[model samples]
Target chain A: MKTVYKKPECIGNKKPNSYCPGCMHSIVVRLVAEVLEELNVVNSSVMFAGVGCDGNGAFGYLDIDTVISPHGRALAVASAYKRCNPENVVFTYQGDGDLIAIGCAETMHAANRGENVTVIFVNNAQYGMTGGQMAPTTLAGMKTTTTPYGRDPKADGAPMHVCEILDTLDNPTFLARGTCTDPKNIIQTKKYIKQAFQNQLEGKGFSLGEIVSACPSNWGLSPLKSIDFINEKMLPEYPLGIVRDR
Target chain B: MEKVFMKGCEAVAEAAMRAGCRYYAGYPITPQNQVPEYISRKMPKLGGVFMQGESEVASINMIYGAAVGGTRSMITSSSCGLSLMSETIGWLISAELPVVIANFQRGGPGIGDIGPTQQDYFQATKAHSNGGGRMLVMSPGSLQEAIDAVFEAFEKANKYRTPVYIQLDGISGGMMESVMMPDAISDEEVAALKQKAKEEWAVGKMEGRERREIVGGADSGLPLQTLNQKLEAKYLEMEKNEVKYENYLMEDAEYVITAYGIGSRFARAAVNILREEGYKVGMIRPINIYPFPFEAYDAIDYSKVKGILSTEMSIPAQFIHDVQIAVKGRAPVYNYSTSGGVILDAVEIANHAREMMK
Candidate 1:
């Protein structure tokens, strides 16, 4: 007997994505597409894209209704979209820099309100499109274009653990952190993404899935080495697990 | 129906309910704060959604999202809060989304005071958002007009698929008066309205059809010039059909007083007093400020008119430039202004008109 592995119908045939080589955005997007197809929600799902490199190419890779919002405004827009059309599934694709830095207020408020929406946050530890500036999720000692020598705790403050912070909020129905470091981690990430959508579909308000991703070009490392970096350096700071579930 | 005595802010909120608005997002700011308060308590009872956004910026973006989803939505703010909202207002214009915004203006240039002032004349009529955007700016002088503008604002906003503004000052926002509120539409009617909008233009459920993409940037594949030309055509249509104003005693007059909103009330009163004194004085009250009643001035017998007085509540007079252009040098333009939320009295305005005539 012969078997066939097929791409989900939700994934547009516009590949390969425009993201740089070894970037994890395409992988995460593919997993989301597959989950949407399995849940039979491809027809009513809408994706709100952010301004990062990954977000700029999201609409091209996903065949669904999409709206690209200003930097740090995707959550607010997605919240409104979900409130207006409760039957349609809405989510936002945001980077760490967009969600944890400039959009902290929106991220907190939307979750506090328990809006029936999902947020897919990709934390690459730096601003990838704008040349790897130090982001809120950048590790304590990590070096980026903005950090120069290194991220100084005295001057730049410690990196924020968004999952831990959001776990304190009582309104979020689901909050989890996963990674794309290896095939095993990727599968785990996909599981979390599916569960987040399931929570929203079940009318469980405010689900968030954070994916710890790698940036090879910005980290000045090869694609394979970047995965090792995430395993050694980023994993300890951001432990992968379900931070909140109620 | 008997007239309902209500505050201007509450009347505006009730008017929005009558217009079938199902979503409201706003932040609390003085003068206009009552608007959001009323909506917050009432919308949920009507099976509508209401959100108190963290900031004015977030509130405007929320409305942008709801509007794109083909829902009747509105937001209210005061002068300073409106300044914070200018960015998203531009986004709404760029995307050609229909949304209603009501501003109960307070004194400003930088938190000047909490008093009523018409200092936002240039901000509203000349430039609201970037890229030369224009909105149908309707200034209401009375509580009755304030209620009526809110109902008509949603109509015109959806009609043109563009943003419309209801400009009021803090005085009217805080005052109480009898207003005939429009009856609410039936629940079935509201549902049908939403259904028609979604099927025609909303970004909802693209099943069995090409997916929809609404962008607020030049990425729509249309060149900047092309997009601007389309907007210009719409503005011209508005100018042709929507310009509104009142001509009082202009049949045989030597001096014409041009004013709007509260200033019009004072100007009209001054004109009546001057007329009783056997002086040829009249008033031209502009209801729509954007497509300013420039053409209305054409009816004036310029050969007999000596001057035009532009009255407002701002220090350095605004709206005079439009008056000058309308007069075309046929009659000299003068101004009478009182700033810092100081409303000029009818007696004082009458004296000023007397001086201008001299």
Candidate 2:
């Protein structure tokens, strides 16, 4: 019998990932691995893993050269890495808090400068590695550990739309948002990721794919329920599809 | 090798370029701004990268990235700007990337002032970052010395696989001096250095080698302890091999003065004045502020030496703590410091030494 699918060769099997059950990080990691392998650029690629649960398992799972950047500075690191090694493909995998909050300046400026790199922004609406702290992407009325009484629009402000923010920047070559809630969405998200990487390989400047991911452990919902929550809550605030494709 | 008159910041930038520093990322800050300005104009012409990061924080992280890419990278800033870079500096240390950082310090407990001060002594030498790690801090007193230190810093950083810091005050950064300019490393030589890094450890294509992972952030319990121990061993090795200092007129001296950076200039002047007045005074200037030349203090004759004076531009005397530690209570260590950008006076320092003798 011919095998239809197997793990991507770029993913190492030495250690099991530490992501929680039903965490979208595992799928996203596989998608990225598959993309890198498909492009045949796995050997020439360097991944900058931002500080979050999304990046915690990157080194263990991905069989590629990886640099775990200090929290929220992945874009800045990736920008310089790309500039220094222009022949190599550089990309960043970061969480909402790591990309949109503490590292806002780096993210914005890297985009503005049209750094030739890709950014895989995993927006799970809360800080997963540090438990359920409210992130910049956390929707108003959504509850997190920091927003225990639910995020009030007055106090917490509205959810941040990162793709929309980057849409205003003239330098960005690609900006797309997709989710990993279902098989259909996962495929679409992978397409966006592939495009982002392709853009980098083509020397197109500053491509980013905002992946609306799920964190069941932090959202206090069963893995199955978190999928439903994404459809009901997150998509309305963030929306899905390309905000810019220059 | 003709001596050329150049401003301190420009000279240091030229020195770094000559030292094979191919990547520079920094922000605009007083005194040190000239460093980035000079590089921005010259780096691209020589096939190097110069980035004006959005903030000091981003600039240092960019240096971290370039270092990871196996390029000679550097960042320069002043006191307040360096404060913004402390977190990334800790990350760079933990990751064990060899990068150079220069701080042209100004007065600061806050925004403070844009004038020369050595107030960052503790910050640079002791607690450079939150996590327990140390940089090989070099304190250069003049334009020539600063250029020399920049060259040595890159060599030492690559040798040890750790960050090397060049500590300069505003006086050293702003003043002009005649210095011999070093020849730039040829393109072939720079390429060879990068090739060696690719073979050993840099993050890049893993064609035939095992994939490299550069880990940063806190490890816990035994892992954290082990990491700390490893760092300590590296630091100890540096202490053994890299300690540098200058002992001026130390032989047969009854009184000794200790200073670093611009303060040493003042101390030297005071030493000359005191020697003319028949009061035997010498100076011990710490060139490597972290390894700190404790042996120099040990070599002092406390029996005949009445006192040791620590002179600097910080208000409450930060550098004195290291001086005392080096002296180990052999003699009373007194401080003659001027704060908030006030330059130390040779006359006042001489008077203080004379009073100690009396």
Candidate 3:
């Protein structure tokens, strides 16, 4: 008789999931929930879900107060969530498309306004849930499904640098970039998440982290290859480092 | 009773105190900034708290958060700020969170000047704001009414467990006037009201947190997750029972005017002039716009009244539509609207009403 590795009990095990193999969403959920459980704030925490595979399933998985918003409006919902319930631990997890595209107004305003909330922006370069559409962070000459002609450098602007953009905002207290493609990076990414969350909990205003993650299904590569892609390619464009630490 | 010669803003703070509101969160904005300044100085002395939030959008959300925690709370802003707050206002309405939002409206398509205007009637009464929804709209004419309306807005808000607006502006908010403060609501009264408010409007905070029947040893730790079903049923009841209006001189008039707040005050003066000029005119002032006073029309002397006039400061007019529906072709609804900081004066209002008489 042998026992295989078990998923964290904190994650809601609701049958089969829609995410691709080696997706980091389950781990991320477990990590955050563990932090919340450790803080004894699982019941009091309210998270706004973005418009992605990771975003939509939050309400079902978290067993806590949750709100789902239109693509890119996570910051706006989180702003309201934090505003109305300042005592509660409120945060948002947005995708690259969700943060940089339709939600840009909300994101900029939420940051510039210095709202007391944390934004965990998952930048996978391409839209993952919608099957590899070009996102704001899509690399120059990157071949997303929408950019099949290999993302013409002229037509597609360079992969957006969001952490730097947010860092420039005077109001935000902390801004960092991290990845979860490997074990070493995972520890650092978790540290960034904790700091971002602490910024809100301390009532120090907005904090964000631009997470450089891999999308194997969308990247036209195997899970391990995409993980390598993040370490090798995405890091150069995004450059994993603290843009603003306060 | 405190006798204070105060601006509309000061009166609101005093009224908020009298009504049992102990928490205030807002930012500084023209025509309404006085509210935050007033609270900042007053709240601490009264054993309450106030936060000058970062923006109008953030300010309203803070109101949402504090109210959910069972603190009597409010947020105040003008038009530009209110537009920023529209998204969260919808959520508060959806969540049926009891909060008082004071709208000291200003002119705007954008940066449209920070004078006075009643341009929010449509935005308030449209039954939809952020992607289309509803809010309880209340307008106050006099400085006294501004105070009273806020107090009533809180009571009504907590009663129905919904957000209520005390819509004021340059005409109603900026003017200097003397108001004898209404008797301060006793501590016992506020406590009793708060208890009733919790029972009526508050959804418990956590699972097994509903103390509806539990006797003692309340779990102070977990707030209940007041669920989807219970809120839906509560919302339906609110929609049915939460409308208030003030009807004047409709008993023997030949033409009645539909109005509210400053407009209603102007219409009252207009009716007096109309009566002297040998034409009978009366005015209907709706206290609550969403649960509109459809019943007021039921009680109106429709035989005497032939038409109605709807006056507001916003151009792509909003309240006139409600007037049309409430009258239902029994009397044609006429529109008298202007934008860009135009406050309809007594003479202008009288003329508008007199023209409809002819």
Best by lDDT: 2
User: lDDT by residue for model 2 over B83-121, one digit each (tens)?
Assistant: 999998998888888999999999889999998899999
**DockQ rank order:** 2, 1, 3
TM-scores vs. true structure, each candidate: 0.96, 0.98, 0.79
Residue-level lDDT tens digits of model 1 in A1-246: 765877777666644567888999989998999988999998898888888875776756687777877677778888988987999999988999888798888889888888889899999999999999999999888899989889998899898998888878889899999998888998999999999999999999999999999899899999899999999999899999999888
Residue range with the least summed lDDT across 10 consecutive positions in model 2 chain A: A9-18
> What lDDT score goes with residue B307 in model 1?
88
lDDT of 1 by residue, B34-113 (tens): 98999999999998889889999889889988887888899999899999889888888878888899888888898878
Q: Report the C-alpha lDDT of model 3 over B158-224, residue by residue, as the tens digit.
A: 7767788878886666777888788777777766664565455432234443222110011112233
How many pairs of residues collide in each model? 0, 0, 14
Q: What is the DockQ of candidate 2?
A: 0.76
* CAPRI docking class of candidate 1: medium
**Whole-model lDDT for model 1 versus the true structure?**
0.87
User: Per-prediction DockQ scores?
Assistant: 0.68, 0.76, 0.12
Model 2 CAPRI quality: medium
Candidate order by decreasing lDDT? 2, 1, 3
For each model, chain A TM-score? 0.97, 0.98, 0.92
Candidate 2 residues lying further than 4 Å off, grouped into runs, are B218-222
